[model samples]
Target: MTWETVPLRSVARVDAVHVAPEAISTSDVYVGLEHIGRNGAIDETYYPAAREIKSSKNRFDGRHILYGKLRPNLAKVARPRERGVCSTDIYPILPGSSVDRAYLAHFLLSPEAVGFAAARTAGVNLPRVSWSALGELPIPLPPLAEQRRIAAILDEADALRLTAICRLRLFQKLEESAFELVLSVSR
Candidate 1:
């Protein structure tokens, strides 16, 4: 399939929100850089209640894709399920025009996109891709239906990978237990 391409800004709004402390309710959810996972995963448990944070943060709804801007190589980006606040290091991007949010999230996690961010990253120790640089990155634009289809396929692949990793860990634990039992018998 011939996938048309566009600048990242053409299909999405990056760093489009900033919320004052008082404006956000204590009950609101807060997503930090740690909450985002590699390859578009999100660890919801890592988030804190909005009241726990004192400084200003970016506001985002479920529609936005939360991305970790601090280290682009980590590929920390995800689509949240509810409205919330996130760290300044995490950009909440909202898809525009014919763009699919899920597709956009997957795209951000792609090697090419991650490389683009990594290349544009600034700073010595804490390298980061400024919002302006992120917006200028190139992105593929497929039809909305196709985008959803591609996203679904990618999601299934991700699920399979997670399952495989889980099984590997379980097997390792079983092996460790068996080894311990053998040592006890030898003693």
Candidate 2:
């Protein structure tokens, strides 16, 4: 039997959410809306740490896909590194190693999943994506090798984009410095 497509709940366990503290600390690693990128990469540095995070918040550390369960937040899914420690509002998805996390991440971050999550969101304030709805999400699966290959391509593209951004910023800084020096001398 080919399980080309499977419900997320089958390959994973969706935890009952534990609410985190109102604030974060350096000791506590927080996973908030900003940590995850649209491309499914987790920029850990972006997620600030607080001194303390509440225990009730979902603990997604190591090898799990981190998902922002709050409405527009669902669009920011990523696979966290250093496993364990995240904001109370962030939902952690631990994908079975058997399933390539990169592949699963792509699926979760897909437009389809975002729409699904949005439809089920409960709160009027933030349009929270319900865990049950998230769990029931159907994901497209591919073999491990294929998943890795896809991930690698995505990673390469990201690196190139970042490189270009740095170059652009550096040039801008140079221009500003030169202008400042010339203008200062003219004055």
Candidate 3:
């Protein structure tokens, strides 16, 4: 399908939620930028009780896309299913009518979008892309129907890739254990 390229701002609201730390309850769900995995996996282990957070954070709901604006090369993006507060470094983007949330998240994680964000980042050690720059990113927008189709296809691929990575890690661990056993037996 033919897609029309448009600036990200045209189809999404970047960092739409900005609230003070005190504004949120300590018991609320918290998502740090580090909690966002490179493979669109939200690190469930990183959720600290809202009271544990000392600084301000962005609030997002199920409808928004959580994007790691800091160190964009990591390509961290996810659509959280719950309402909660997230690290200020992450932008809680809301997609417009023409764009689907899943589609936007996948696009943000794509190599083209990631590279575009990386090129616009500022700072040498801990670079971050500003909301303005992120909003200006060029996105190839397809029809809503086509976008859903693309997103579904990408999601399936991502799930398979994650499964393979997990299996590989498990195998490596088993190999290490076997090698250790062999060395102990020889000793």
lDDT of each: 0.87, 0.71, 0.87
Among the numbered candidates, top TM-score falls to 1
Highest lDDT, which number? 3
lDDT string for model 2 (33-132, tens) is: 7676776666666544443444555666667777787764448787766745665567677777657777777777778888888877888887777677
What are the clashing pairs of model 1?
none
Please report how far candidate 3 places residue 75 from its true position, in Å: 1.5
Q: In candidate 1, what are the lDDT values of residues 51-107, reduced to their tens digit?
A: 667888999888889988998999999998888898889888889968988889988
After best superposition, candidate 2 residue 74: deviation in angstroms? 5.7
Q: Which residue ranges in model 1 land beyond 4 Å of their true spot? A: none
Order by TM-score, highest first: 1, 3, 2
Candidate with more favorable, higher TM-score: 1 or 3: 1
lDDT of 2 at 103: 71
lDDT of 3 at 71: 93
RMSD (Cα, Å) for all candidates, in order, is 1.7, 3.8, 1.9
By TM-score, is 1 or 2 better? 1
Q: What is the C-alpha lDDT profile of model 3 across 103-180, one tens digit per residue?
A: 999999889999999999999999999989988989998889999999999999988998999999999999999999
| Candidate 3 lDDT trough over 10 residues, lowest sum | 44-53
